[model samples]
Target: MDSHKILSLLGLALRGNHLAVGEEPVEAAARAKDARLLLLASDAADNTRRRTVHFSEAGQCLWLRLPFTKAELGRAVGRTSAALVAVTDIGLANAVANRLAQLDEDQYGEAAERLALKAKRAAERQSELRAHEKNVRTGKYRPKPRRTPEDSSPQVEKSPPDRRPRNQNRSRPRRGSPTRSPHPYAHSRPVKKGKGSFRKRED
Candidate 1:
């Protein structure tokens, strides 16, 4: 069937629980070997596409390529870039196959040709998923490293030297008059103002 019709059929099959999603053509091909049906994106690489075709031919699995981009396929399958989806359950497989057959008959006169195309696409998707998985496992798909404690540690600033205390810097008061003078009236003698005799009243 055409990519669009195939995608529609695959989309319906995905609602069932028998499908395995893959990001690489190899993985998709592997999944397809045990699956009743496989779905692939139309825009997968040529090498992946050829491998998928070979896989389908060797395994006798039904495969189809949707007319969507990898990104579109990913979005449809709730992933970033899904290459393949395999239907594993026998009942689900039969149901999807029957539906796909009907869609192929209705949409394209060459049901056999459409089926072949579908198989090719499924293989491609599987291969893509396998490659992607390999890259991730090998650390080729390395993510940004997170910050460690050393990277985020707080810096401590050194304090300045302290000055001397006020008592240590104090000096004696300046001298002007007598430094230890006594009371101002200490040597003064009292005289009677209205005394008649020259002798002092010593009583």
Candidate 2:
């Protein structure tokens, strides 16, 4: 196996902040479902291996026993010693696994293939999300029509048409005639009943 190249890739991942070193961080990543792949040093203790297995199951990720020892893995990640590491990025995880698979097909081939498929799907989903967001910003997204209660309710029966003429129920004045005044004195005017004097007689 090209251990040097693997170590270089591990260092790159660390530098990119894609790696979670040590048990606590790895465990946190696994529990949060952020871990894509986990690497355990070949020299790790039995208990650590058991915990890595548990974490792999919890995170639904793959775990591999690296060919390098704890010290080598630690140096690659700038740590004193590291028995376990988690790769959170799918693309990086796939790259690292592919390299490992090239070195040892029996051990890493299946895992590399799985990570590749996962990375592809993740990329496709991200593209789809970006397209959807673009459509919304460009005013091309068509929202589904909303259904209201009135739409779903049964049609109401129409009221029967009036049998009488339209003007029969309404008292309307003739066009050129004036309407009756409500006030009794509205039409009262002074009259010259006694000669040149105009007087309003009391009714």
Give the best candidate by lDDT.
2
> Could you tell me which 10 consecutive residues in candidate 2 have the lowest summed lDDT?
190-199
**Model 2 residue 53 CA deviation in Å:** 0.3
Question: Each candidate's TM vs. the true structure?
Answer: 0.39, 0.73
Model 2 lDDT tens row, 172-203: 78789977788978778866656665577889
Top TM-score: which candidate number? 2
Clashing pairs in 2: none
**Ten residues in sequence with the least summed lDDT for candidate 1:** 106-115
Error of 2 at 199 (Å): 65
Clashes in each model (backbone N, CA, C under 3 Å)? 23, 0
Off by over 4 Å in 2: 154-203
